[model samples]
Target chain A: MDLSPIWLTLKLAAITTSLLFIVGLPIAWWLSKGRSFFKTIVEAIITMPLVLPPSVLGFYLLLAFSPQHGLGKLLQDTFDTQFVFSFKGLVLASFIYSMPFMTGPIKSALQQLPVSLTQASYALGKTQWQTFKSVLVPNIKPSLLTAIVLTFAHTLGEFGVVLMIGGNIPGVTRVASIAVYDSVERMDYAAANTYSLILFSITFVMVISVFVFNKYQAKSPLE
Target chain B: MIDLSIEKRLKAYRGQQILKISHQFTTGSITKIYGPSGAGKTTLLKTIAGLVYPEKGKIVVDSQTWLDTDNNINLPPQKRMPGFVFQDYALFPNMSVLAHLQYATNDMEWIKRLLLLGKLDTLTDHKPIHLSGGQQQRLAVLRALAIKPKLILMDEPFSALDPDMKTELIAELKLLFKELAATVLIVSHNPQELEGLTDGDLYIP
Candidate 1:
């Protein structure tokens, strides 16, 4: 088991989760608060990555981020950087692939909430942004935690999208899951087994952590 | 002072027709809304809090326009400053008693007041879910009060409590509101039930 691949997986997960949180928060907020004809369409599109075949997502993502497409060419021409076969490309792919995992819990939790939580803050003469940052975020703690863990874990185990966009460029886009596949193909079962076990352990820990936190919340003093 | 003349069509799925009701709350006094199960009590309270938008009308609280459907203006809940406690509404699951109060303003003195008000001094460190139902109801009051809004809206705040706890809460509220001169609006099935808490004015529908 090469340590580089392991580190790369962790890095990918971190970058993807951080990026998603920045954009996903507003999107989830809108879904919970607003009603529009396009709202359902937007939600379905966001969740498409979850249900879509990983390979199909990878294929479209590869084309979308490549220099051939408008977005990809714009990024390259403007920033003097290419996304394909790069760490950035891997992050972008992981972000799209695991978006639903990040947004689903957050949206549901926000919806389940009463406007009272945020209202309470505003009534105290606080600004809306301040209220969201302080009151809403802290109140929806478990949902945000769940979103982070699921997105990170999902990004860590990602294969298809990374395979298409990242192209297995060692030391750059060669994540642990891909390395595991490469190892098995090369008849290195021990290395593959090690990588597999690590991924499993990481995911197992996240699931267990969620359960423990929920149980703990159920016993909170402010019930 | 809060004044709302809002008309909202509430779509109820439970065999009740769409409801269109318009009401107003005047300034500087406790207003109790008494109605049967299907009456517009909760809707009225929530509208004043900006949680629900009325179909038509104007809402002016303390000279600020909150909602004017004719003028096409509706402020979201985050823009309104009203302490609200819906029936059985609990504090956030992720926060402890102290953390929940932190939203009101990280002011330690006010937190202490709330802790003492609800007899929650020892439970300040505990999470909301860990408390008993009675404790939760008490915390709800303290949480709403901690915000120090000009007005407070409670939807059947005492409905679920045992008689002893309800009377104790009402007695406690009388002292608190009279001392602060706060405007507390309550919605209940039995408008006359909470005599100890009110100033002896009940508006029944």
Candidate 2:
């Protein structure tokens, strides 16, 4: 049983989760502010991934990044980057696939905070960025942790998008989910079962930890 | 001295009501504001602090134009830099009694003085959640004072404190306000709370 697929899957999940955390915070913060038609449209687009089938997202990403097409052609000409059927494509696909998981909790947490918290910080002469970092972000720690974990777990379980854009290539795009499917197709029951169990156990542990942590937080006097 | 004239449209239950005010506050004066509910007392404070922008207003603080809708100049809250104590206390649940002051300024001596003034020096490490309502309210007041600001706006700041505690704290705060030469605007539902402390009075109908 080759372990390359498992390592690749872990790497993809780590990279995708890290990038999503950095990108999602600002997006969530902006969205959590006063609502508008433009913000509603952007939020709808970001949230579409949660309800839309992963294969639909994968299909669109493939069309958008195919080297023979407009955007893909421009990228190929300018940056010499090929997204389709590559690790980069897998990472990109996972971003769209797992974005809602990264932004949902954070946005809601931010919205639930008292308006006076920000106002108090501002009245104290703290800049917006300073208040966000020192006050807003610190207060949203639990939700932030939940967002990171859910994004990582969701990325690890990604199968449809990876299949559509990132063709199963050993040591590159052949992540655990793809490997499990390949094993099953080859009638390799033992390998399929092993990979399935590993993925299932890891995700279960992560989800359980989130529940436990949140429960502990609920019981604490300080929020 | 601060000269402020502002008008804001508020969404009252009975159609819309406009809040209009034109007032001057002398430097180092403490003014008590009293009004019925929905009269926009808090909104007035927020507008002055730059938390809320009035539809038409001019706020000139010590010759500095903080807001002038006619001139289209509006300084943000950070630039205005007034100290404010919110009605809800608005203490950071994650920060200790000391961290709140530390976030405002790095003056160790000032911080120590504020801690002692609020009588929260012994509870420096305690978060807002652990403090009693009075303690939390005092901490909010202390956090506002930590900046040693030229202006302080408070909304129902002593509502949570017992009468005796309120009196003692007010007495101490009066001397401190004089020492710092800070002007203050306090919105109170109870007029008696700030009877002797305020030199001026503003009543909103």
Candidate 3:
């Protein structure tokens, strides 16, 4: 069996998860703490991908990533990088598709935390960033772990959006899900089963570990 | 000295009322803030600490203008850096007793002394969940004092402690407050608890 698709899928998941963490931390923190009128609108927009049909999001992203469009044209002109049918395009599409998976748990975790914890840190002369890093992050470790695992697994299994945006370009964008689809289309049941088994095993382990870790955290005195 | 004249519109079940207060507290003094429930006692302390904003007010702390609504110069809480002990003892669940104090200050000797003052030296490695109510309250107070802040605001700081523990802790705190020359404002429902420790009183109606 060709392992290129598996390697590509892993690379995409790793990159997307890392990017989501860097970008999602502040967004989740704001959604948890901010009281602005625009917060509702922003939250709705972020969560839209979760409810919308994957085909619909993929279709729109395809247009937005077209070189003729505003965002796509701006990137093309500024950096001379074509987003359509490229690895970069797939990364951007996956990031959007998996955003809520990344941010929802984090935001809820932060909201569930007592406001006094952050306030106490502030009163102790710690800056907002310092408090977030030292106090808020450590306390919400379980939720953060949940967020990371969910986003990675969700991105790894994405099908419709990856199809529309990434167009099955062999090593470039032919990730595991797309590889499974290709195998089935070619009537290669053995190849399809091989890919499916691996995906299922990995995801099962990740989800089970998350639950075990959560149970351990619950039993621990500190958490 | 800390001087403040503030007015905040508070929404109550009955209706809306303005909490208007003007006062000055001398340096190295302990003031007890006594008031009925819904009288804005906690709000007053929060405003001083820059946690809550007063609609109209000027707060001067140690000759420095911390808040001036007229001038639009309100400092944030980190800059104010006044030690605040929440009514619920907002100890971090992930941090041990020693970690809580260490988060506020890097001075090892100060942390050691603070642990002794709170009688938590033995439980330095314990988290708040493992601590009893009185131990948690004492940890909160010790964490606040760890910063050696010039101004300290405590809301119901002794509600959980037993009488013997309260008496012992208060006596030691009185000496510690003097040594640091800190101004303290304590809000308590039972005014009798702080009768001997407090040098001044502010009744909020």
Candidate 4:
């Protein structure tokens, strides 16, 4: 069994999750707290990936990453790095696909928190960043955990977008989901079953551990 | 002296009305704000704290203009840093009793003294979930005092305490407020409860 696909999938999930956290936290915070007129439009755009078909999103990404025009042309001319059919391309696609999974929970978590907590922090002379870091983030641990797990798991199982943009290049973009598809197409049921079992077990353990940890935290006096 | 003249349009189920207030509060004095429900008492406190903005207003604190609509200047809450005790006792659930005070100041002696004042010394490590209603209220008061703010605004701060506890805490707080030379505005539906402690009164209709 070539475990390279598993390693690539893990790497993709890891990088995508980290990038999502960096990019998604500010978006989630703004969506949760801001009352601007443009909020609805931005929210609708971010949530598009959740409802749109993966192939639709992938097609647009493919066009955007094409070296002939727009962002792809700029990247090719300046950075000289091709985004399509590469690990970087796969990462970008996975991030788009998994954005809602990361941002939704975080936004709801921030909204559900008592407004008075932030007010209190401000009254105590703490800045907005201080209040967010010391008060809001600590209290919303459960939601943060849920967002991370869901984004990681969702990215791990992604297929259509990865298939369209990644093109199944082994050792570079051949993630576990693509590997399983390849095995089945070749009538290699044993290899497909092996990949499927490994994916299922890993996801199940991750989800179960999160639940167990949450329950334990709930039982603790501090929570 | 703290001077404020403000107008805010408030919409309630009854109708829309203008909350127009103009007043001067002396430094180091305790003033009671008495009003019926929905008369904008809490809103007034929030406005002074810079948590809410008024349609038209000027708030001058100690010769400093905190808010000046004509000048288009409105300081943020952090810049104002007024100590406020909410009616609901907005203690952070994730933070322990001691952590709440420590977050506002680095003075260990002040923190210890505040814990003693609030009678929360023994429960320093306890979170808000573990504390009783009165204990939580006391913690809120202590947290507000942690900054030794020049102005303190309290909304129904003693509603959760028993009569005896309220009396005792108010006595201690009166001395502490004087020591800090902090102007205090306390909102209450029952003004008699604060008769002796309040030096002046403002009625909102």
Give every collision pair in model 2: none
User: 1 or 3, which is superior by lDDT?
Assistant: 3
lDDT of 4 by residue, A96-208 (tens): 89999889988988998889899999999998899999999898888888889989999999999998888889999999999999999999999899999999999999898
What range of 10 consecutive residues in model 3 chain A has the weakest lDDT sum? A214-223
Q: Which candidate should be chosen as best, given DockQ against the real structure?
A: 2
State which docking tier applies to candidate 3: high
Assess every candidate by TM-score.
0.83, 0.96, 0.94, 0.96
Instruction: Pick the winner on TM-score between candidates 1 and 2.
Output: 2
User: What is the C-alpha local distance difference test score of each model?
Assistant: 0.78, 0.92, 0.92, 0.92
* DockQ list for all candidates: 0.42, 0.90, 0.88, 0.87
Candidate 3, A206: how far from true, in Å? Answer: 1.0
- Residue B176 of candidate 4: its Cα lDDT? 97
Interface RMSD of 1: 3.1
Residues A1-223, model 2: lDDT tens digits: 7989988999999999999999999999999999999999999999998888889888999999989979999999999999999999999999888998888889988999999999999999888899899999999888988999989998999998899999899998999999999999999999999999999999999988877777757632112
Candidate 1 falls in which docking quality class?
acceptable
Q: Write the per-residue lDDT of candidate 3 for residues B1-205, one digit (tens) a residue.
A: 8999999999887989889999999999999999899999999999999999899999998889999999999999999998899998889999999999989999999999999999999999999999999999999999999999999999999999999999999999999999989999999999889978999999999
Docking band of candidate 4:
high
